[model samples]
Target: MKTADCDILILPGLAGSEEDHWQARWASRLPTARIVVQDDWHAPEPEAWRRRIAEAVAAARRPVILIAHSLGVVAAVEAAPDFPPDVVRGALLVALPDVEEAPDLPDSVRAFAPLPRDPLPFPSLLVASRTDPHCAYARAEDFAYAWGAQIVDAGDSGHINVASGHGPWPEGLMRLAGFLKTL
Candidate 1:
């Protein structure tokens, strides 16, 4: 479906997306896109994050398409089962951090350990970087296989965030546009 025909929910990771973050920029550019605000971004609570995502999907006037990064990707996968299959059309999951193996993981994020492995009910794509500090490429491939998502190799990009110099990532926008077309 065209972007105007759906609700694009941008789900940022811990600490939320800043003005320079790509997710924020994309949300601003897409008329139907909005950020899914969490109650606490610095101290993430898995259940709370999941509930917020569910609420956002529930409130969408049209089919929902999720654009998630880092920890937000984990929450989306965990909350997928709770969402009505017809409500969510697709998702673009980027930089999925391996919290289970991440050293010095914050207590808040550690609570979401052992990430869910169930296949999502809707179409999904997982984009991972070969040089991401948070997760290994192999692990990302494992996640794609388990979740039944198509995997996209994003070269050596680091975490694919603003800190990684992706504030106005046009290539990512193209990828998102492609994903949206399939829905």
Candidate 2:
């Protein structure tokens, strides 16, 4: 499906994406895209994050296409089963953080631990970075496999965020466009 035909929901990671983050840039460019505002970003509660995603999807006027990064990816996956069937057409999941195993993350992330292994209900693509501090590349592959999502190796791309120097992320936009075409 074309972008214009879907509601693109941009779900940012912990503390939310900065103004220069790719998600934020894309939200400005993509006519139908909007960020799903979380009630709290500093210390995430898994159930609240999951419920928020479900609520966003439930309210979409058109078929939903999720653009999620880091913790948002986990929340989206956690909320998958709650979504009304077929309401979500697809998802572009990037930089999935290892909430279960990452030692450096805050303790609160543990609430989202033991990541769900069920296949997502919609078509999806997971873009993973080999050097992301939050998750191991192999683990990202595992997530993609479990979710039945096509995996793209973004070699050495640290979390694919602004700090990693992906402010505009034109390449990501191209990849998203390609994914949309397949739907």
Candidate 3:
């Protein structure tokens, strides 16, 4: 489906997407897009994050398309089963952090461990970086298989965030546009 026909919800990771973050930039560029505002960005609670995403989807005027990154990806997966199938048409999941194997993960993030393996109810694409510090390449592949998502290898793009020098991330925008076309 075309972007104008859907509500694009941007779900940012831990601490939220900053002004320079690609997710934020994408939200600005896409007139139909809006960020799913979480109550707490610094120390996320899984249930709360899930609730926020659900609320955003519920509030949308049209079918929703999720643009999620890092922890946001986890929250989306956890919340998907609860959402009405027709509410969410597709999702662009990026930089999924492997909290289960992340030794240095904060207590807040650790709560989302043992990542949801249930296949999503809608079409989705998972974009992963080979050198992402938060998740190993093999683990990301495992997630893609388990979640029933198409995987795109983003070579050496650390977490695919601002710190990784992906503020504009035109490549990601292109990929997102392509994914939207499939829906």
lDDT of 1 at 31: 96
The local lDDT score (0 to 100) that residue 132 gets in candidate 3 is 92
1 or 2: which has the higher lDDT? 2
TM-score of 1: 0.98
lDDT of 2 by residue, 1-183 (tens): 899999999999899988999999999999999999999999898999999999999999999999999999999999999999899999999999999888788888777988999999999999999999999999999989999999999998998999999999999999999999998
lDDT of each: 0.92, 0.94, 0.92
lDDT of 2: 0.94
lDDT of 3: 0.92
Give the clashing pairs for model 1.
1-183
Which window of 10 residues has the lowest lDDT sum in candidate 3? 77-86
Question: RMSD, model 1, all Cα superposed?
Answer: 0.8
Candidate 3 lDDT score at position 95: 97
| Superposed Cα deviation of residue 123, candidate 2 (Å) | 0.8
Question: Model 1: which ten-residue window has the lowest total lDDT?
Answer: 101-110
Ranking by lDDT: 2, 1, 3
Per-model TM values vs. the true structure: 0.98, 0.98, 0.98
